[model samples]
Target: MEIETTGIPGCYVLQARLLRDRRGSFIKTFHTPRFEELGLRTDWREEYFSASAKGVVRGMHFQLPPVDHAKMVFCLTGEVLDVVVDLRRGSPAFGTALGFTLSAENGRGLYLPTGCAHGFVSKAEDSGMYYKVTSVHAPEQDAGIAWDSIAFDWPVSDPELSDRDRRHPRFADFETPFVFDAAKAAQ
Candidate 1:
């Protein structure tokens, strides 16, 4: 895997090595050593995926600290404009965002350290997004900032959002508790 910085201090955009043949292709999605060498959190406890139709918007979500997580996500099928907002209280990139296009064709992915909110918009029908997270899911700990409040430029105006997601507080109204500790997050 090759790593690229996401401008946000600890966030990385990973490009998986794809091997192609006459019949098909194969790619190594994860390798413990490489992630360790890069100082990313590797203690993943759960994995999940979300499938959305075109124009559907899925997130801007994160869990509260003590239950907060770092995530590595990639597009398993179709495509998405993956978006993340820095919410680390003392982060240099706080309140900012970055967007990357993840698709089955390019085999690209994203790694977000704890404190950023993550979400995506589907660019194709039946888009599937897969994730490997450092923390287990907790319903009570789940939270998000309003998707429409962030500065990132989403492609669609009429994004399909769930009522809960639609009701999330605006970015300006959020009071983040996550702190930006390089050493702590590297674990």
Candidate 2:
């Protein structure tokens, strides 16, 4: 796999190398050594999958401090427009967001640090996403920034979203709890 850093600090887009033949294809999606070299968390406490239909928008969400998690995400089937925003207060890209097309066809994945908010908009008839998290889910710490609050140009005009996501507070209305520390990051 090849890992490439995104504009946002601590965020990465990982592409897997596909070995193809007449029989089919094989790809190594994850390997601990490569991840360690990149300083990405490999100690995941939980794993989950979500399936959504085209035009469905899922988040702009993250958990606060004690439960904040590092996540590795990829498209298991179909395609999606994955989006993330850096919420770490002291970071240069705080409040800034980035979007990428993650698809089964492309065999790409994303690694997101604890201080970022994550979400995705399905681009295929049905899309399945798999993710590994460094920490378990904590309901009390669950939080989010309204998806529409950020300056993003979503391809879907009328995206299907859950009531909870629709009710999330706007980005400007939330209190950011994490701060980026370059010193700590280097460790």
Candidate 3:
């Protein structure tokens, strides 16, 4: 696998090398040694999956403090417009976002560090997404920035969002709790 850095610190676009034969194709999505070599966390505390239809938007979410996690997200079956926003206070790109097209066809995934908020908008009829997290979920700590509050060009016209997501506060309304620490992240 090859990892490419995004404009935001600690956010990466990962590309796996695929092996193809007459039957179909195969790809090693994750390997511990390789991730360790890149200084990424692999001891996942939780794993989750979501299935959504086109125009469905699932997040702009994150966990605070003790439950904050580093995440690895990939498209398992179809396609999506994955988005990550830097919520690290005082960083150059704080409140700014980076967007990418993630799909089974492109074979690409994204790595978002603890201080980033993650979400995706489905692009195909039945897009499937899988994610691994370094920390487990904490419902009490669950929080988010409203998807429409930030400056983003969502590919969909009327995205279907959960009531919880729709009620999230605008970016400017909340004070971010996490701050980017390059040294800590590098460790």
Give the number of the best model, judged by lDDT. 1
Model 1 spans > 4 angstroms off = 185-187
* TM-score of candidate 3 versus the correct structure, residues matched by position: 0.95
Every candidate's lDDT:
0.90, 0.88, 0.87
| Model 2 misplacement above 4 A | none
Ranking by lDDT: 1, 2, 3
Per-residue lDDT of model 1, residues 59-94, tens digit only: 899999789999999998999999999998778888
Q: In candidate 3, which residue pairs clash?
A: none
* True lDDT of residue 154, candidate 3: 81
Clashing pairs in 1: none
Model 2 per-residue lDDT tens digits across residues 111-130: 89888999999999999999
C-alpha RMSD for every candidate:
1.1, 1.5, 1.3
TM-score of each: 0.96, 0.94, 0.95
lDDT by residue (tens digit), candidate 3, 14-100: 998877789877777889999999988887899999999999998899999888999999998889999999999866778888899
Q: After superposition, which runs of candidate 3 have C-alpha atoms over 4 Å from their true positions?
A: none
lDDT of 2 at 23: 86
